[model samples]
Target: MKKLSIILLILGLLTGCSEKGTYIKNTTPYDEHSVENVLMSNEHVKLAKVLLYEDELLAGIRVNTFSRFKKKAIANKIQKKLEREYPDLKVTVSADSKILLETEKLINKKSEKNYRKKIDKIKSIEKEQT
Candidate 1:
């Protein structure tokens, strides 16, 4: 019974430490599969919230706990890579929880009438925080 309990504890810890799946919310006509592939390629990225709006691409990522120290570097690298891939669109990638939450809200809202304005507001907030 004690050995079974120890095994169960080990399994629980392993599952808890594993990376979560990525989430991409693309309202654009572009192929979302490509973007998903790009984001999932990085092993450090655990959870991601991505929004592809008109002329802009915003992404908020949560890295593995151990990789938190270099989260900024990771975000920047991904941003640059995405920018290279889609040069016509403005790309913003952040590791902030506020940005992630806001992006998720925008995705769920499904209203494009004020998307540009909201995105700009989020960008300004990001600038202020940095």
Candidate 2:
């Protein structure tokens, strides 16, 4: 009975750590599938929240615990790659939890009227941390 309990606990923990797929909210004409493919190509990314509004592309990603040390590098690499793919759109990517949470909130909003203002606020908050 004890051995069974132990095994179940381990399974529970592992399941809890499993990665959730990317969340993308796009208001533009861009192909969402291609963007998702680009983000998922990196093995270290655990969860990603992306918002595409007008000419701006903002992404907030969470890396696996083991990759936390290089999370900033990962964010930068994703940003550069995205910029190369979508040169006309301004790209911003960050691995900060605050940014991730804010981006998720933006993605879940019912209306799009204040998207630009809220996005600007989130960007300023991200800038303040640097």
Candidate 3:
């Protein structure tokens, strides 16, 4: 009975550690909800998707504008806000329709590799615009 108690204690400790580790893994560098709220508060934005990957931020936002010329301003505004708020993070923002579509695809295939690829694509797209 003493040996069984010891084994049970070890098992309980192992389970507790796993749960704590999971909480850390799930947490973002910043307050994810507040970040989302800040972006959504913009009058021009319709949809804003923000994901925190460690210290980097990957945001795909859809602004309420049919004019292509207005998109650049909107994207730049978002990029500035994120950079200002999270100086340590490598912030990448996009108002491009193509980037938005790609982001939706990543929602289904969520892997670190996929996020890296998506960020690269968004940056490339951002470069082309600017």
Candidate 4:
């Protein structure tokens, strides 16, 4: 009876747990080298690809982009850069609540150089309110 109870407890613990939220992962093992970065653009249209792939992005990602660039162009540029690094991953541009919700699921990546940007929709509202 004691063994049965122990087995049931173990099974219950293992069955209910899972990792949630968005995150990037290296398909390769530790011996393989890997890098991750997040770029920024003024328009959501520019971030379509990244946002589309938000499921793979961990929080606190660092992305680079040309300052004062068009939305679509910036997205295209980022796609080009990512292609060079990860050709296997398909990237697309999509600006919508679905992608943002996925991004929100990511665990923030921490670094000395903060790449985190203020989400635009909220920023614009603040601007109007002020």
**CA lDDT, every prediction?**
0.87, 0.91, 0.65, 0.37
Each candidate structure's TM-score, on Cα atoms with residue i matched to residue i, is 0.81, 0.84, 0.65, 0.31
Ranking by lDDT: 2, 1, 3, 4
Q: In terms of lDDT, which candidate is strongest?
A: 2
RMSD to true structure for each model, in Å: 4.6, 3.5, 14.8, 16.2
Clash-forming residue pairs, model 3: none
Q: Per model, state how many residue pairs clash.
A: 0, 0, 0, 17
Candidate 1: where is the Cα deviation over 4 Å?
1-19
Candidate with top TM-score is 2
How many backbone collisions does model 1 have? 0
Which is the winner by lDDT between candidate 2 and candidate 4? 2
lDDT of 2: 0.91
Residues 39-86 of candidate 4 have per-residue lDDT tens digits of 432322222222222222222222223433353355455556655655
Instruction: Order the candidate numbers by TM-score, best to worst.
Output: 2, 1, 3, 4
TM-score of 2: 0.84
Q: After superposition, how far is residue 117 of candidate 2 from its true place, in Å?
A: 0.6
Candidate 4 local Cα displacement, residue 65, angstroms? 13
Write the residue-wise lDDT of candidate 1 on 1-130 in tens digits: 9999999999999987565777887778876676688889999888898999888899989888899999999999899888888888899999987898899889888567899899999999988943
Give per-residue lDDT, candidate 1, residue 97: 79
For model 1, the run of ten residues with the poorest summed lDDT: 16-25
lDDT of 3 at 102: 64
Q: Per-residue lDDT for 31 in model 1?
A: 69
